[model samples]
Target: GGISRAGRDALGEATAKILASANTYENQTIFLTGSKAYTLKEITSFISKILGRDIPLRFVSLEEYINQYLNCLDEYWVRLWARTYLALKREELARVYPTLENLLGRKPKSLEQTIKEIFTDKQTGEKESKLTNKYWQASTFDNK
Candidate 1:
């Protein structure tokens, strides 16, 4: 308990120091990504406030086949994330899509749907390689 808090405080101080130094540098780019959308936004805003410039922090969903499959097996995790996607509790379907819910209807039901939702360019649109396909493709963080 104490150790975790200590590590957290140390991290906060280190982050502050980095922010201060980065402002002095004035041209370095910072990327933020995580499951905590709010935390990522906060960190990105903090850096922007320090730098007095707009930082391009993009959000990408974290989608992984093995991870999604494992999570689907966990009933509780499935319910929570499906609700996040507003999914209709389909045990038959392995993964859920928030984008599809946002579509209201006519949801795309394949790798094609997911890709169309991501890339806006109709001409150059293509599915991600099996190795790289995941829920979110924001420029902030890479999956393990």
Candidate 2:
């Protein structure tokens, strides 16, 4: 079974609605989530499709990112945090919840639609405008 990933804005909207009917869900723990689950790879693929370009994915160790960006931190803590991040990434994050839909009284946005709302440029169909130019300007590996 896959877990659903809710868009942040969608989740917020659902939360507001749920709160408005506090009497109904009072004293109960409600699970709020997107209507569907998606893996990181799936999300990346969707972004690529919307951009109409292949986005290169490069896997780098957490240590590398930390070393490059947070070198001021203590070595031991950095390694510890990186290990924790790696472990979390390896786990399943997809969560499906009916509570959100029930609370909203309407179907929540699908993962694709949610992603498009977040990443797509409505006017030009380009991914973050800056990235579009960079993506197009980069030479393909075949060219090099």
Candidate 3:
């Protein structure tokens, strides 16, 4: 898939900055994104280099994808996501916009930076959530 990936920290910062600047950016819609678009292979290559281990890539047909996940997911889910897979295959979800960088006053986090933030020492200057502590609990796909 040719879709974009943005770091959560950058997205959060951008959102905060935009909200604080509501008067300056009022009534304007924006599309935020990472600086560049990457293919799955390029993304995995970043992961491989960072983790110092090979992240395997398996190219499969849409049918194969549906069949593989159909057991864990429902028939409706598997069937519905066939459209998403097709869109990804068609490069329909990929776009990079400068709004995020502009708002953050610097480049959005690189893939490596985001990965390191997640996998390395989790130290960052990001603020603690103003929301309830329960918001800190992250959910995975299975959990969600």
| Top TM-score prediction, candidate number | 3
Candidate 2 residue pairs in clash (backbone atoms < 3 Å)? 3-94, 3-95, 4-36, 4-95, 4-96
How accurate locally, in lDDT, is each candidate?
A: 0.35, 0.65, 0.68
Q: 1-144 in candidate 2: lDDT tens per residue?
A: 233677787689988987888898899988888877765557677778877777665556554556644558788776665554354364444546688888778888888887787676778766766443554321111111
Clashing pairs in model 1, backbone N/Cα/C closer than 3 A? 60-138, 61-136, 63-134, 63-135
Stronger candidate by lDDT (1 vs 2): 2
The residue ranges of model 3 lying beyond 4 angstroms of the native Cα positions read 23-27, 74-83, 121-144
The root-mean-square deviation over C-alpha atoms between each candidate and the true structure, in angstroms, is 19.7, 6.9, 8.6
Report the lDDT of model 1 for residue 33.
15
Q: Residue-wise lDDT of candidate 1 within 6-95, one digit each (tens)?
A: 123333544565666676537854321111122334544544443345556553334532254454387567435534322212222232
Stretches off by above 4 angstroms in model 1 are: 1-38, 61-138, 141-144
lDDT of 2 at 26: 92
- The per-prediction tally of clashing pairs is 4, 5, 0
